[model samples]
Target: MRSSRRWRRLCGGRNSMDHTKQLLRISDIAAAAPDVLRYRFTAAEGELAPFLPGQYICLYYEIDGTTTGRPYSIASSPREAEEGGYYDLFIHVGGSFTSRWLGQHGTVGTTIRASHPLGEFCITPETPRKIVGISGGMSVTPLRSMVRSIVDSDTDREISLFCGWDDPAAMLFREEFTALARGCDRVRVRFALAQNPQPEDKHGYFTAEDILRETDAAEAAYYLCGPQAMYDTLHDGLTAGGVRPERYRREVPGELHCPPYPTAPGECYPLTIHTGSGTVTATAAAGESVLVALERAGVSPRAYCRSGSCGYCRSRLLSGEVWTDPDRAPATADGVFHPCCSFPRSALTVVLPE
Candidate 1:
């Protein structure tokens, strides 16, 4: 491990955060797709920390004086992390501020703040079983980590991966995934092309029917990471096919894009939020997420992975009615909910964590 003094030197003598936050420098960048880039980062002066195969790191960026963070899945296996002293993140050029900033400034030697790995979507080595991974578009980043880990560790566990993209040019990590399949007998890789597929690819979107046809659906531990529509289709199809819920897990890449609430158009509701410091009130426009409402009122709340997969924005729904994206809604217990994916349906009150 590198010393803190070295880290400070590499980071221009900046003070380190007490927690897992680190200042890292981009070491390399490679085009993964037409709109996707693979960014490799290393500790300014020390070895990078190890992370689970399916975990993610939050990257913080300051744009127009507003600091915001976005979570990107770790695309490298744990073994690679230990050996290379770096982390790999595959980012798509989306409409988000962070993605736009990265597209412009993600050059080698650019220093940025990043959180340590955080997420629970990983394989438990002790509970080994046949594994099936399903992913779509850039969401394949974490699944690639899981699959690579399995191959690097020389685990005999049967692994089946189904990855889909809009087309061959849109597919990220195409060569790498194909190489892994060729090297490992227990690993099976399939590609789904949604449009203008080449002769070697499977046409159409990735569906539950593909999983059922390629792998042992009943016995394998299924891991899914993709768009919400994919989740809904797979969840319904798998359940109807008699697969137990416990045998499957899922992770959505970003905040849910829910349809407009059935309220009259242009309607807005009052939203009162009570935090440890004081109470803040704001108006939540129809079809807008409560998180956006809070931001609009200049209320700064700690949040990451705005897609609702991360529990960082969880708060207590003290009063009022809110509708959550069904696919991204966290399990509600004792009135707890993730406001990032919640839409106010009525005048609402919520208690924010300190």
Candidate 2:
């Protein structure tokens, strides 16, 4: 009886917590839409890692000699791990991870490694204004957790979710949004699809006009997560429609294809990178990304979010010509770089800061 009691206590208490943290196993992969698949991961012994709303986790994979790690937002609500013991994520296959993620089936017993829980995109008491979120396409991942938390916490503050996508078929978490809109009197959802529209739909890309027509623009704080094009479109549309810059709160995707603002005087150029130790120089061409050239020349720089979001490979430019993607960690006017995405714009020499 004593042993059983001890075992029960251990299993019901700290041991359960310990078990809740073993990486994860791909329990199920359900197809959400045409290109989207909901990859479900569960703890080995039916436990889950404790996580928070809006925080993301890292998915590790080895493609070649270099190990690539990608950070993905957990679309599932925090309650899943805090209350239950399963972690669910909605991933749409594309670009970088498309071939790998699609080829690997997330069936039961498939093992995968992931981080505890990470990210700064969440609700807080200090969020002075009522919630207002604007997302585009796959950007819905992080907001899904936030919206679910808002409803689950029973916060009386009003919220409006304005989401835009390419089309109806590409929309994610449709059922979840529907339930949220139906369940919370304080929650309102406005969905826009460029290709197709319902009778009361807002059409084409979301314009500043839509923001003005739908809700009070200035009174609320804004949260934006979306593709680069959507961001650029919204920036012009909002300013033209009178939405001040201060009201705009945005968290860029870990990777960006284009800049939201105007392109600078220089785009990309050839350069020679000088390593810090012995001053080894590697030839890299303009327009070709820094990381790409370095890898080609057999130089390895540590990086996680190959995109600018993770400052893993940020390097200082002793002196040279390089174009850095926007939203990178605070680089000096002297020129710092996240080599993973930095492209050379002039034949310059820089010491790889690692």
Candidate 3:
């Protein structure tokens, strides 16, 4: 009763926050791919926040006492967000977080922190552009939720999903998508394979000519969801193939910036951080992001996605200034910033974005 009272008090009051803000637990984790696991997390009861149909969530994970976060599009529909149902997360069971998920020997009730769903990926309730999905491998994650939501609503639009995989095993949602396409009258599904296959086989790599042969890009809204190399290859090809820049929507592997931004060696500087709650200052070396310096300094300010993507490690530029490689800092009107990849040019002053 005492512990529950504390939990209730901490989440209730003026400026009160809810358990919705804490680390949720992994209620169940299942295997989907040889290298991928589908995680179903249970937030505190009655603590699930309402989310949109096409939004993504930032997941906070702790491995070997180290901190990090990655944002993933919710694979479940908004309808599932209510009624204390489950939210689905898919991760290739490798690397740090993947290793932990696979190694934990954990099961029901294992805890994990999941922030409120955040992202702008969504399909409109009314906008009807010929929907074209160019998916590669696990790129079907987000689109599956979209297909479910769209079909459940029974909207009037054509959804043509073009999926490319090396083999049947590489496919993400083969049976689920096939089932949806079978039932929906307005949905047309197409399959493409890159590997040499049986005599009766699908095409490969979703080339420009293949895209043109399949669907006229002139009046279509295209969504490309896949890895970095794949996104780059298809984006350039589709553009050259006459797909309007506006009509193409691709999901960025948000935190994972390829070829890590070039930071000149031996160009380090000092950093000062001030929070309304407290302040800590340190010297940051070049070739390292402010987030790294803070973490090394034992300043456990919240953070996620080392790239300036998820906006979780957002701090404020209180006095001194810093420089972002692309200068595309996600600073809101309140002056919050992504400390993850942000570097110091001169002596700098920053505070947690309130």
Best prediction by lDDT: 1
Clashes of each: 2, 5, 4
Q: What is the alpha-carbon lDDT of model 1 when measured against the actual structure?
A: 0.77
Clashes of 2: 5
Displacement of residue 157 (Cα, Å) in model 1 is 2.9
The root-mean-square deviation over C-alpha atoms between each candidate and the true structure, in angstroms, is: 6.2, 7.6, 7.6
lDDT of 1 by residue, 46-118 (tens): 6675566787888878766656677889998777777778888888866565697899977899999887777
Ranking by lDDT: 1, 2, 3
Model 1, runs deviating above 4 Å = 1-20, 45-47, 240-242, 257-259, 262-273, 278-287, 293-299, 317-321, 330-335, 345-350
Q: TM-score order of candidates, best first?
A: 1, 2, 3
lDDT of 3 at 234: 75
Question: Model 2, 1-354: lDDT tens per residue?
Answer: 442332233233321222112468877788888767788777765456555556677665545554444567888776665565677787766555523554465567777666556444555444534677889888888888767766666445567888888878888876778788998887788888788777666776677677767766667667788876777777777666656676666765665434344455445444556675555566665545676666655554555455766455667676666677655554555566777767665566666663
